[model samples]
Target: MKVTLKLPKPRNPLVAPARARKAGAHASYNPARKVRRTEKHKLNQALSGRKTEGSYDA
Candidate 1:
């Protein structure tokens, strides 16, 4: 007598998670969106003489 072994089906890696599979789901961070400060804000910072650099200032 011969016996056959059963194996589980493999999941598809290309498939997105259930939460992401839903419609109208958007990521918190979108690269196309402008995130950096505007030129006006930069000018204000320069005028204020505030150092935006890291711990090197301390």
Candidate 2:
């Protein structure tokens, strides 16, 4: 017979303040943040059809 154990989450970790100020209603969501974080070398679908040869990616 085999046994499995479920472990509890950890505690006592120090906390760090966010570098960016929290934005209210004026804040906008970047659809690209998800793609940039999860997938490497992949561009956000939101920007799949946009042009960037003007100044970026140099």
Candidate 3:
């Protein structure tokens, strides 16, 4: 009779979500200076009930 051993799978880093994978905020060309940073602006937009496009401020 022969016995078999089971091996456990190794844990890997969790893949970041699509939103989280996005780049951080940055300064863009805004004469009105409405959106200074992309990330911060996005958050502010969400709070203000504005549509967020998740685009860089470049």
Candidate 4:
């Protein structure tokens, strides 16, 4: 015995985004700043299990 399956047609993609934009305000993306020394040191220590040795103050 053999069986066949049928799938429904996909809806138009353009209709969804237009409806969403009209409903609410759109969001904007902003770039992030460079990481701080303290943050970098902590991340390094967490990953390597050792404190970084260096002069942080210039």
**C-alpha RMSD in Å of predicted model 4 compared with the true structure:** 8.7
lDDT of 3 by residue, 1-58 (tens): 8998898987555754654676766765575665445557677877787755554245
Please identify model 1 stretches exceeding 4 Å from their true place: 1-37, 52-58
lDDT per residue, candidate 1, 1-58, as tens digits? 9998898898887776764766774785665443343545565666677745331221
Overall local distance difference test of candidate 2:
0.52
Model 4, 1-58: lDDT tens digits are 8998898999999988988875643453323323465566677776685654462333
lDDT of 2 by residue, 1-58 (tens): 9998998987545433443556476435776865576453334533674544342352
Off by over 4 Å in 2: 15-58
Poorly placed runs, candidate 3 (over 4 Å): 1-36, 52-58
Off by over 4 Å in 4: 23-58
TM-score of each: 0.24, 0.20, 0.26, 0.31
The lowest-lDDT stretch of 10 consecutive residues in candidate 2 is: 49-58
Candidate 1 vs 2: which has more TM-score: 1
Best by TM-score: 4
Ranking by TM-score: 4, 3, 1, 2
Please report the TM-score between candidate 1 and the true structure. 0.24
Q: Which scores greater on TM-score, model 2 or model 3?
A: 3
Candidate with the greatest lDDT versus the true structure: 3
Q: What is the Cα-based TM-score of model 2? A: 0.20
